[model samples]
Target chain A: MLVLSSPSGAGKSTIARNLLENDKGFELSVSVTTRPRRSSEIDGVHYHFRSRREFDNLRANDELLEWAEVHGNFYATPREPAERAMNEGRDMLFDIDWQGAEQLREKMQGDIVSVFILPPSMRELKVRLQRRAEDDAETISRRLANARNEIEHWRDYDYVVINRDLDRAYQQVLSIVAAERLRRDRSLGLFDYVTRLLDEQVD
Target chain B: MLVLSSPSGAGKSTIARNLLENDKGFELSVSVTTRPRRSSEIDGVHYHFRSRREFDNLRANDELLEWAEVHGNFYATPREPAERAMNEGRDMLFDIDWQGAEQLREKMQGDIVSVFILPPSMRELKVRLQRRAEDDAETISRRLANARNEIEHWRDYDYVVINRDLDRAYQQVLSIVAAERLRRDRSLGLFDYVTRLLDEQVD
Candidate 1:
């Protein structure tokens, strides 16, 4: 599964949506969460919203692939749905953060391919954060601090793309995904299936 | 299974070799052939030479993923060794033609990610062919004709990268492979394995 993780305002979600729109083969892996939805958020679309108790129950039962808490609310990935999609040969795209990515990587086989988006510099990060106009100075400051912590984990990912230019970064992300699909380990089963036919001819 | 295909002088082999030298995880899929070895070629490294009878035997049994004739000599991809490498979690890189890619994709479920390397223009391609200091003008012209025919298969590939500048193209190729590794369908089994552990937990 391809998990794209970046700090808030780094444009990971936008990139993921663009990739999904361009590639019909990709399926977005919607995360489930215990946090209350914003007015615009749609249940089962933006997220599968469960109550805190239900979320806790799911976690306790091991149904969640990976889960974590931020500001007292829990967010997680539902294990079953992603598996069903993959088994059906659909690729899943995840827009997440480093913490969630770390958890997902650990719980899964080394199948998780991760990419970290980085702003060109601290100055550029602040410029982008301010451009969003969604947060005030204080909130932006807090976010910038958190962003530093997140970017620190960039080394953990397979690719680190600097979003200095949106178009170039998007292309880089697309290329990475395209190349990964060709990975031999992922496609070895096809080799076996083809070899079986050869075996048939050998006898 | 990232297939990098281009015209005879497009430098795909050079890029593939560079990638192999730097990336330990990548295994070059050596082609099997019935052609005589040139003085510069090495057996089992550049290619595995086989007798016409053995080649016929492999073809009769469907052991080759793809096979074709060039200058009255035959070449093929031996299915078993490449498959084994991939099954063991290694990424295999193929420097083959479009026909080989098409055949391989048909026979197996390998990620089938193909990148067509294009010269900046016909003029550049001709210049590169001449710069090789090998073939005569007639051969170079024939190669250019062949390149145009081969490039018609670009739409069949997952990515199209123009090798205008070598370093930039190299980086783009690396980016493609890195992102592809993160594909969700490819990594789905990893997620399922992690979720299986949750089966023991109770709500």
Candidate 2:
């Protein structure tokens, strides 16, 4: 599984979307959130919109892999899909914050590869946020404040990509995933494959 | 620095050559060897030819990063060039065997990224060795015997690429290097970069 975490306006969502669209091998981990869905959002595609009670119940029962309170709303990753994906030899991608990423790392350990994306500069980050025009001045300021705290955890990640250029950042993320898959510990069939190779005739 | 290792016929050399030719960023770590230069080999380009006494003196002085007795000839990586490359923020590639890789790992630790290449099958490995026709039958047989020992060390590497196709293998190696360079620990300027980001105005 691959986990990507970045502060707001750092282009994690764009990179995640590009990976999902281009790489057929990856399945996005649809998060469960208590926040009200936007008009443009699909129930399952954007998030598994949950009632507060349901979110609490899932968290209490350990059915949620990770849960956090964000902007007064609860958000989480369901446990079942991610576990099933691993068992079935399928790859999963998690677009999450540092808290969610840390929780996943605690639970999944070596199974997860986490990357943190940094904006080119705070100036660029502010520009990107303003360009998106998704938030009012107060909300943007609040996000900017949170971004500093979020970036403090950059060293927690296995890899970091500076999102100076979206295309280059995306390519870096792609390369990390590709290389991680080839790691000796992750490639399950290697032992058997090597055994078969040893059995082959030299002549 | 990147180290690529494989048995004689597993195509590590080909991948290394391709990387050196295509990527100007990487410098090949030319090895000093006591082996007689082949008719086709250039002394400095292929291997730095050295007298047995010179090789022993270097090893005694710990001037060799890693060394091994192969086919009764001493082969070693010069310590100075690799140290200089790392100091200068330049990347070097080592086309060495598992023994050499392990020594580099022991000495450099996190500074080294090692990759192990595996031929698709033993049959393919033998075919490639025979096709090259560089060594006589006895020498080829010796290499085939040693291949099993080399394959056992695959788990020692950070990454493993099955050389099923040369182009694909080269691409994988390229991806590994690109991603490794962006690792939080390796990207030395990241601390200052992040610090500068923090100093920017929130508004």
Candidate 3:
């Protein structure tokens, strides 16, 4: 499991796309949200857009592993699908925060490996957020303030990558995901099956 | 930081040495212990062999992070020296158990990545122990029993690698260390420095 969380415009969305495009075993988890879609965003593909009432129902039904309100809107992961993917030995990638990562960790045992992406600096973060030209000045100021608070919880993650250089950050995250997949606890079945042949030779 | 732990003759020592040889920026932490030196072992290089009285004094004074009695001998890490190395930006590697790893985590605010090496199987573990040809059959049995208990704490570790195929296991560990060293928090200075350049350009 891999969770790549950062403030908006931190290049995590780009990094996530490249990772899923390159890696065969990984599936990007599409989140459901009540947030309004941007001009380029698509439903059921970019996000599973739902009404506030539906999101509220999911929260009430205990269906979400983790959920959060952002900019007066809601977003969440449907718990069952993610668990089913993990159980079948597929890796799921999440673009979420500490709250979601923590909840996922509790539900899964030794599977979640959270990586927090830090912008080069608060100044650079503001620049990147501004470069998008999507949010207004007030919204950008609000985001900068939120980013600082989010980054303070960087210690909660298993790994952290500063997105100063996009190529380097992408390569670092790719290596982490690849290395984690080969962990002995996760690949025990492969080891056991191979060792049986060696056992037969000895017997 | 990476800690590799396994029972004696489980090939963890060999794996640790291989990782050290191939990886740059990783230094093996030389431990100070009160154990009698084997004929082939070197002093100060392998271990700082201390007197029982000195070991007891260090343990009593709280200089040692974690110490354990095994076969009537004591072994521990002097916390100050290890912290100095880490503070100097060196990734100190440990060939220690879950107990020592836990102790290090509690005392230090640095990152800890533990890898538990599993023998191919219990049968192979027994074979590997017997192949050591150092211990008698009774001692080998005791070591095998101990390995089982150690493996039970596999969940406590962040990563696990099985030495089924030496080359594969070595590569897996190498990749993990490489990825961990690139963690964002440790590279914060680099990010801040780079961001300053960008800030200057914009101004």
Candidate 4:
């Protein structure tokens, strides 16, 4: 599991999109949510849109990896798909907040490699937020304020990438994924591999 | 600290050489030894030639990060150079054996990122040893046996790279280095940088 957290406008969504489009090896961990889906959103693709009762049951049964309540609607990462993907030897990418990241880490510490993307500076972050032009001035200001709260949690991540240059930051994330895949604890096939190597004949 | 360990002829030396030559950010942590230096080997560039008395003194005083006796001669990594490199914000590479790697990890658990390289197969390893033509058939056979002993310690490393293709293996190591550099604990400056970021004004 790969978790990426960033303050809004840090280019994390852009980086994560590039990774998934280019690397077919990863499957996105589609979250389950109680919020009603919009007309443009598709079920299971956008989110596993669940009823409030279903979301509550999933949480009660511990079927959710991590869950959050926002504005009285529930959002969660379903455990089944992520586990199945891992068992089938596929990597999973998660775009989650710091609190969700901590929960995932607690449940599955060894399998997860979390990265926090940082904007180059607060001023630059503000500039990017304003440039997006999708938000009102009040929402933009609120996001900037929330960015500091999120940025304070940067130290909790396994790796930190400063988005000074989008391409450079993306490449840094690629490196993290490649390197984590080589970790010995994660490579269970290595045992048989080394055994076969030692038993091989030499001329 | 970055340490690379592999059995002979597994392409570790070639990878380390290429990394040092291409990347100026790394400084080789040259080992100091009691063995007489070869005519072709420079004192500081290759190994720091030292007397047995001095080596013993350094080890006793905890001035050596790791020490071992090879063929009745003492070889050790000096603590000063490695620490100095870290203080200067430069990565230091150690081409050391498993025992040395263990010692380094014990001394500086948080700082060291060790990688173990494996030959593609035992048969391939034999071919590499024979191709080198540096030793007789008997010596090559003995080295092959020793390779298994060394390969068994692969679990001790944080990452493992199988040298199937030299370039790919090199890239994997490069990725490990890049990712490890971005580790939250290692980037000490991030704290102050984030502080400055939070305080910066946005208009």
Q: Model 2: how far is A85 from its true place, Å?
A: 1.6
lDDT of 3 at B97: 70
lDDT of 3: 0.77
Error of 3 at A139 (Å): 11
lDDT of each: 0.77, 0.90, 0.77, 0.88
Q: Write the per-residue lDDT of candidate 1 for residues B1-203, one digit (tens) a residue.
A: 88899877777888899899998889999999998886778999999999999999999997888998866789899888778976787788988888888888887676667887766666667778899877778878777777767766666777766677888878778877766664444553534432342232211
lDDT of 2 by residue, A1-203 (tens): 99999998999999999999999999999999998887778999989999999888898898999888877988899999999998999999999999999999998877888899999998888888899887888988888888998999999998999998999999999999888888888888988988887777775
Per-prediction backbone clash count: 14, 0, 1, 0
C-alpha RMSD of candidate 3 = 6.2
* Native-to-model Cα distance after best TM-score fit, residue B55 in candidate 1, in Å: 2.1
Provide per-model DockQ scores.
0.12, 0.78, 0.20, 0.73
- Which candidate gets the maximum lDDT versus the true structure? 2
Candidate 4 per-residue lDDT, tens place, B56-113, comes to 8888898998898754888899999898997787889999888889988888778788
Deviation from native of the Cα of residue A111 in model 1, angstroms:
24
Model 4 residue pairs with clashes: none
For model 2 the local lDDT of residue A116 reads 96
Model 3 chain B lowest lDDT segment of ten: B194-203
Per residue, candidate 3 scores C-alpha lDDT tens digits across B90-121 of 88888887667777777774577788877777
Q: What is the lDDT of residue B24 in candidate 3?
A: 70
- Quick one: ranking by TM-score, best first? 2, 4, 3, 1
Task: List the candidates ranked by DockQ, beginning with the highest.
Answer: 2, 4, 3, 1
